[model samples]
Target chain A: MELFTYENIIGIAAGICTSIAMLPQLIKVIKTKETADLSVTMIGVLIVGVSLWVYYGFLQNEVPIILSNSFSVVVNLTLLICWFLFRKKS
Target chain B: MELFTYENIIGIAAGICTSIAMLPQLIKVIKTKETADLSVTMIGVLIVGVSLWVYYGFLQNEVPIILSNSFSVVVNLTLLICWFLFRKKS
Candidate 1:
């Protein structure tokens, strides 16, 4: 069996990309204090999704999946909270 | 071995959740015409991420991953374009 296949490489790339995908949004939210336009439902669903991924990782004994999803969950949750905190009160 | 396990269940749930997580955002963007508060970097990175996921899915023969990421990619791209088109003309 080969050590690393193209599939594995692409999966790793996917993992890396997804793991930090929300960072820019978080930074932008923090910097601009703008979250009114962001969708609460999207953030809520993402939190649920990443949480399940983490649980799945734990059940499957996959360390990388667990870590990545855990990070994503935290970041997404932070974004959610930021949305609540920073949204303009018009 | 049992055909379905807790891990598999959670994974499925996660997949379903992530697959549609962006839908709400897409709807919101379309309805409200608001994308200025959104981060282009985040959308760009997410496009790269989901595209890799689609490639990874093709390599691994994961139909669900491919379908989900493909949907996400389209929605994120639309959001990006909306950012370009609908951003306030200030």
Candidate 2:
């Protein structure tokens, strides 16, 4: 199997994008200490969804998927936690 | 390949969860007309990332991935549009 193919590159790029996408939001939430516009359901569902992806990756032994989605889960967890802390305050 | 295997079910569940995860946020934005706490960069990055995943799914002939990510892209786009519509009003 050829690694680094066009499709693989796109997949990896997508993974990287999603994996790090929430970090900025987390930072924004923390910096602003705001969560009024954020939706708790969205973040909660995403955590469950991404965790399932992580488990599926584990079943398939796909390291990239596991690692990237795991990263996403961590960022998402922090985002949710920050939302909880700041939700009532805002 | 066996259809509806445990791993396949997990994958599908994950897809469904992620595909619909942003809906609540969109609804909140529309109903509340607020976007102050939302991060434009996160939504933009997610749109790009999910769109890439759609393309990758197409290239790989994965119908489920393509469909789910397509739905997610639409939701994310609407969320972004809603943000634009309401950000200034907030």
Give me the runs in candidate 2 sitting further than 4 Å from their true place. A1-3, A32-42, A61-64, A80-90, B1-3, B84-90
* Cα displacement (Å) at residue A74, model 2: 1.1
Q: After superposition, how far is residue B66 of candidate 2 from its true place, in Å?
A: 1.9
Model 2 over residues A24-84: C-alpha lDDT tens digits?
7677788999988677888889899999988977786555457778898988898888887
Tens-digit lDDT track for model 1 on A1-90? Answer: 342566666666777887777677788778888887677887888899989878866665545456668888889889888888877651
Residue B80's lDDT within candidate 2 is 90
Give the Å shift of residue B6 in candidate 2: 3.3
Candidate 1: list runs displaced more than 4 Å.
Answer: A1-6, A32-41, A58-64, A80-90, B1-9, B84-90
The prediction achieving the highest lDDT against the true structure is 2
Error of 2 at A59 (Å): 3.4
Clashing pairs in 1: none
